[model samples]
Target chain A: MLVLTEGLVELNVEAKDAEDAIRKAGQLLVNEGLAEARYIDAMVKGFQDIGPYIVVAPNIAFPHARPEAGVIEKGVSIIRLSEPVKFGHPTNDPITLVCALCGVDSKSHIEMLQALATLLRDEDKLKTIMNPEASKQDVLAII
Target chain B: MKIVTVCGMGFGTSLMLLLEIQSIAKGHGFEVNGEAVDLGSAKGMSCDLMVASSEISSELVDEPVEVISINNLLDRNEIEQKVMPAIQKLSKKG
Candidate 1:
């Protein structure tokens, strides 16, 4: 099961820009031994190469790279920025919630996304989690 | 009908799009053969319609398939609004 543990969640983080936000989220996965240090760079470069398509919704940016970029395990790190940052997306810019995803393979990646998508469907729960005052324990209960 | 969801790496965002497309198609009472592919793989593939983020969708302008560019991938309402009509039209022609 994909669970967002205490180690995987950050709240009210201050980031200068989109790259800084992505790095903060990716760093959580690295600290948990879920991915290599290179994974962070790969994700940042992916944004530059691919554009901000990862800004999947209003105020939400899902940053990720290929597994070969160095995913040691299946993990996701969720970070809520203290201030929203622009990602150059047409409409979904000024992102506040950053989800850095890493998976071992195809099946696991989709599985993790499926779970995340379901959780995201709950607007009330998402609001609670997005609140800067929300604790990691509160997030753990929802995800 | 066949549809393709595309993103840069094909593992993350495209897959999320594929799932939403599948569910949306199912909810609309029609079945679609949906697959997710990277931008490189998508060019050579044959499909009736292609859904991708606006950024990646711009690169597909030269392709033969009908391209639908979406701002949000996870918003089902947006997906249904933009994609379902085309799907329904295709269903009627078929």
Candidate 2:
């Protein structure tokens, strides 16, 4: 089973900008042995070349790269920014959430993606996770 | 009706959205089928409708296909609100 460990979670992260935010999120996955270090650069370039399209929703940016970019295993990482960063998205700028995804293959990350979508959809649940008062373990249980 | 969920990379957020849309549409009795596609592959593509986060949806704009922008990709209620009407509208056209 793919595990969402506390080790993969970083709350209220301080980032200089979107590039920094993406790298920090990518580093979380890499540190957890879920992805390679170079995967970080891939995600950054993805934004530069592809535009801020990674800002999938308002206040949320789901940064990811191809599986070949450096995915050693399938997993996801959660990084909440202390101050929201801009991805230049027309609507979803100043993102406070960065969810970095690493998949061994296309099919494997589907479950995690579904679960994440469900959790993020619930405003109450998202509030609790982002409340700063909520424990990391609480967010873990929710995820 | 056919719909597609799009993201910069098809396998990530778009795939996430496709599953949620599929689940929501099944219960709505819309008889819809859809898939996840990357923006590059999605261009010049046609479907009854398309769903995506606002930033990506703006790029997805084209004729003969309508794009439904979901401001909050994580919110299921938002998806239902934005998508059901489109599905209802499109299914009627068929």
Candidate 3:
């Protein structure tokens, strides 16, 4: 996969649920002309049912929908929260990292998941990405 | 031996926890196999014990396997303190 990294970083994001997070991130993608704006809402709802499964790390969350959920192109958007957002899971502390991913199918999505897993495994790299002062270039550099 | 770690997503916290368990098991001279599985899909997995998030453990009560609930998935000390005993107990059974 080409790993879409251009203009994928949002300095601040507001979200109440996995759907909200993905919608916010998808807006960024659409604004940058990377994907269609009309598909954003459907993508958000498509992942809502499996949304609760997104509590990846203590302060990190990855919200993704199924491949068939209006995904015209495979892409990723990284959003850092100014303040943490709760997803109703006790084990998950408020989240800072909100990664929105869209793919063509399960196999393609798993590749993105593996890439995300690799990035999240690095504590120092994650801390840098979560930093408010960090630029989009800095986030892209790490990924 | 098979060990499975459970969390909200099979890809993130559970995978990290499984890595920790694998390292600890290796140090103890145990050749164990481990994987991270989402709570929804862990039903038929052959695992000696299920190390799961507290939320997941509550949902998995009826399973025959034992469940060890973990508070912070990244806290190595906390995981060792809580999970080591469960592993030892299962070892005795084996």
Measured against the true structure, the TM-scores of the candidates, in listed sequence, are 0.94, 0.90, 0.71
Q: Rank the candidates by lDDT, best first.
A: 1, 2, 3
Give a tens-digit lDDT track for model 3, residues A3-46. 64566778766667555666787876677655676568755554
The candidate that achieves the highest TM-score relative to the unseen native structure = 1
Which pairs, if any, clash in model 2? A121-B74
lDDT of 2 at A35: 88
Residue B80, model 2: lDDT of 89
Return the lDDT, model 3, position A40.
80
Per-residue accuracy of model 1 over A1-143 as CA lDDT, tens digit each: 67778899999899999999999999999999999999999999999987887887788888988898999999999999999999998777799999999988988888887777777778988889788788888888878
Minimum summed lDDT over a 10-residue window in model 3 chain A is located at A44-53
lDDT of 2 by residue, A55-140 (tens): 76678887888899989988989988888888898777888989988877887767767667677877788898778777788888
DockQ-based ranking, best first?
1, 2, 3
Q: Highest DockQ, which number? A: 1
Scored against the true structure, residue A52 in model 3 reaches a CA lDDT of 48
Worst 10 residues of 2 chain B by lDDT: B55-64
Q: How much of the true contact map at the interface does candidate 1 reproduce, as a fraction? A: 0.69
Off by over 4 Å in 2: none
lDDT of each: 0.88, 0.82, 0.70
